[model samples]
Target: MKMLKEKIQKEGIVLSDTVLKVDTFLNHQIDPQLMQEIGKEFAARFKDAGITKIVTIESSGIAPALMTGLILDVPVIFARKRKSLTLSDNLLTATVYSFTKQESNDISVSKDMLHEEDVVLLIDDFLANGQALKGLNDLVKQSGAQVAGAGIVIEKGFQTGGKEIRANGLRVESLAIVESLVNGGVVFAEESVNK
Candidate 1:
């Protein structure tokens, strides 16, 4: 988590008074070493939760999800942002709204990927409005699977997303929580995963 904080300080951009852009190393262009460490940190944070499976929203969340799955030696299941014909005929699907993109994506997962006997841990790159997590959480509920918690790489503390999710009584852990973004600078929360 210390390394992630340092990377954000070095490369994360404050796009607006509320949005933190981490595309340089997180969304678009990836830093493999940073990603590996991120996976390790998630594993360490959620190690005691009895995680039988790892879940995430597609596109952006795939990297960290896969990494965490590898480190934890659990199966990774991602909710697809778009449905593909290639996806098996039998699947579980849910709709989630993206606050940043200002749109909704119907995410889908094959039926065989998850089971009622499993406990799920959800992971994502960012937590803004909690809508995405809501949808993924909905999917888990529909499958009759237990949700262990949610793992986030960066949380916009100014926004109510992370707070609302926590209010829902889910254990949510963020590696970095940004208190605010002002005049192209990032203000971090007093409490971080490092703390």
Candidate 2:
């Protein structure tokens, strides 16, 4: 986590008070070593939760989720943002609004991948508005699966996502939480005391 914080400090670009871009080593051009460490951290955090499956969304969430699944030796399932012809009709769907993209997507998962007997751990690249996680949670609920918790690579603590998800009785573990991004400066929740 310290390494992730340092990476954010060094490479992250604060586009605005509400936007921090980490495409250099995260979403766009990924650092597999860092992602492996992230996966290890999440596995350690949720090791005892009896996680039967790891769930995430397509694109950004896939890397970390796959790494976690590899570490946990569990199956990884990702929700597709767009319905494809290859996808089966037996699916669980939910509508999610993207705070960053400024659009809504109908996300879905195959009913065959998840079931009532599984304990799911949700993983994502970022947590800001909590809508994506909510949609994934809804899919898990529809499948009658139990949620273990959520693992987020970066959490915008100034936003309502983390608080809202926790308030909904879901556990959230974030590698690095940004308390504020002001004037191209990044401040972590723990480092706020030093300011």
Candidate 3:
């Protein structure tokens, strides 16, 4: 996880008191090595959990999801934020409020993609307020799949989302947890555990 912390320290930008823009290596510019490392890390943590599928939201989650899928040797499925002409009407949905974007978007997946027999592992690039994870968890529940756990690339440790999700008794793993980003400096959680 030091790799992640180093990347944030070097390339992450602060847009506001609450927003950390990691567009350089995470959300925008490609970093295949880092992405593969994250995937391998998640795979190692949940390797024995019987995760039949890995679920993530659109855009930012795609890279890690595919990488994780390769590590797990299973399929990765992404929930589309918007429905295009090809999205069927029978898709399962959950509305997610993105605090960063300050907007509500519906995330959905085809019913055929996930089923009752699946054991799902959810992944995302960031976990702030837990809204996106909540929506994805809802989709997992609706499909009758057991949520094996969730793996996040970066978690805001000072935020309530990580605590709230952990309180719900689901396994949660974060590679790099930011305790604070005060005065243009990144502070990592001291006692953070990667697995």
Candidate 4:
């Protein structure tokens, strides 16, 4: 986690008070070593959760989620943002609003992927407004699966997402929590704690 924090400090771009772009080493061009470490961290944190499956939304969430799944030796399932012809009509669907994209999309998961016996661990690159996680959780619920918890690579603590998800009784773990991105500066929650 310290290495991740350092990476953010060095390469992350502060776009605004509400936006911190980490595409250099995270979402866009990836650092495999860092992602492996992150996967290890999540596996350690959720080691005893009896996770039967790893769930995530498509795009940005896939990398970390795939890494986590590899570490956990569990199958990973990602929700598709757009319905495709290859996808069957028998699916669990949920509408999610992306605060960053300023739009909503209907995400879906095939019913065959999840089951009532599954204990799911949700993984993602970032947690902003919690909409994506909510939608994924809804899909899991529809499948009668139990949510083991969630592991997030970066959490915008200043936003309502993390808090709201926690309040909903989901065990959430984040590697780097940004307390603020005020005035183009990154302030981490751990830094405040260490102070």
Candidate 5:
């Protein structure tokens, strides 16, 4: 986690008070080593959660989620942003609004991938508005699967996302929590004893 914080400080771009772009090493151009470490950390944290499957949104969330899945030896399922011709029937769907993209996407997953007896862990690159995680959670619930919680790569602590998700009884483990992105400076949240 210290390495991730340092990496963000060194390479993350602050576009606004609310936007911290980490495409250099996270979402776009990924650092495989960092992602492996992240996966290890998440696996260690959720080792006892009885997670049967890892769920995430397509594209940005896939890398970290795949890494975590590999570490945990679990299957990873990504919710498709668009319902393809092959993914047409018996799909569990939810609407996710991306504040960064300024649009809503209908995400879907095949019903066969999830079941009532499974326990799911949600993963994502960033937690800003909580929409994507919420949508993922909804899909899991629709299948009657238990949600173990969420693992986020970066969380904007200044935003309501993390707080709201935690309040909803979902355990949120965020690696790098940005407290502020003001004046083009990235301020990270102080590490808590509980974390």
Candidate 6:
């Protein structure tokens, strides 16, 4: 997590008071070594939860989720934003609005992949508005699977997402929590907490 924070500080771009772009290493171009470490951290955090499946939204969340699945020795299921022709008739769906993209997407997962007895861990590249994570959590609930927790690569702690999700009784583990993006500066929660 310290390495992740260092990466964010070095490479992340604070676009606005609310937007911190991490496309250099996370959103667009990925660092495999960092991702592997992230997977190890997530696996360690949720190892005792009896997780049977790792769930996440398609695109950005796939990398971290896949890595976690690999480390945990569990299958990863990603919710598709756009349904393909081969998708099954029975699908679990939810609407997730991206605060960064400023749009809503209907994410779906095949009902066959998740089971009632499975414990699911949700993973995502970022947790901003909590919509994506919530949507994935809904899909898991629809399948009658228990939610073990969520693993977020970066969380905008200045936003309501992390607080709301935690209030909803979901345990959230974020590698880097940006407390502020004020004046094009990234202030981490840990730094602020210590102050």
For TM-score, the strongest prediction is: 5
Candidate 1 vs candidate 2: the lDDT winner is: 2
Report residue 171 deviation for candidate 3 (angstroms): 0.9
**Candidate 3, position 5, lDDT:** 84
Query: Per-residue CA lDDT of candidate 2, range 79-103, in tens?
Result: 9998999998888999999878889
- What's the lDDT for all of these models? 0.86, 0.92, 0.90, 0.90, 0.91, 0.89
lDDT of 3 by residue, 1-195 (tens): 778888898889877666799988779886999999989989998999999999999899989989999989999999999897987898989999987788999999999999999999999999988999999999889989999999999998878898999899988999898888777767888644444
lDDT of 6 by residue, 1-195 (tens): 788999999999888899888898888999989999999999998999999999998788889999999999999998999789999778999998876678989999999999999999999998888888899899899999999999999988888888998989999998888888999998888744411
Residue lDDT tens for model 5, 16-110 = 89988888998789999999999999999999999999999889889999999999999999999988998768899999998878999999999
How does residue 1 of candidate 1 score in lDDT?
64
Error of 4 at 69 (Å): 0.9
Q: What is the TM-score of each candidate against the true structure?
A: 0.94, 0.96, 0.96, 0.96, 0.97, 0.96
| CA deviation > 4 Å runs, candidate 6 | 191-195
Error of 5 at 76 (Å): 0.4
Higher-ranked by lDDT: 5 or 6: 5
lDDT of candidate model 1 versus the reference: 0.86
Cα lDDT of model 1 by residue, 1-22, tens digit: 6788889999998888988888
Report how far off residue 130 is in candidate 4 (Å): 0.9
What lDDT is reached at residue 135 by model 6?
90
Please report, as a residue range, the 10-residue window in candidate 2 with the lowest summed lDDT: 186-195
Model 6, residue pairs in steric clash: none
On lDDT, the leading prediction is 2
State the RMSD for candidate 4: 1.9
Off by over 4 Å in 3: 191-195
Q: Which portions of model 1 show Cα errors greater than 4 Å?
A: 192-195
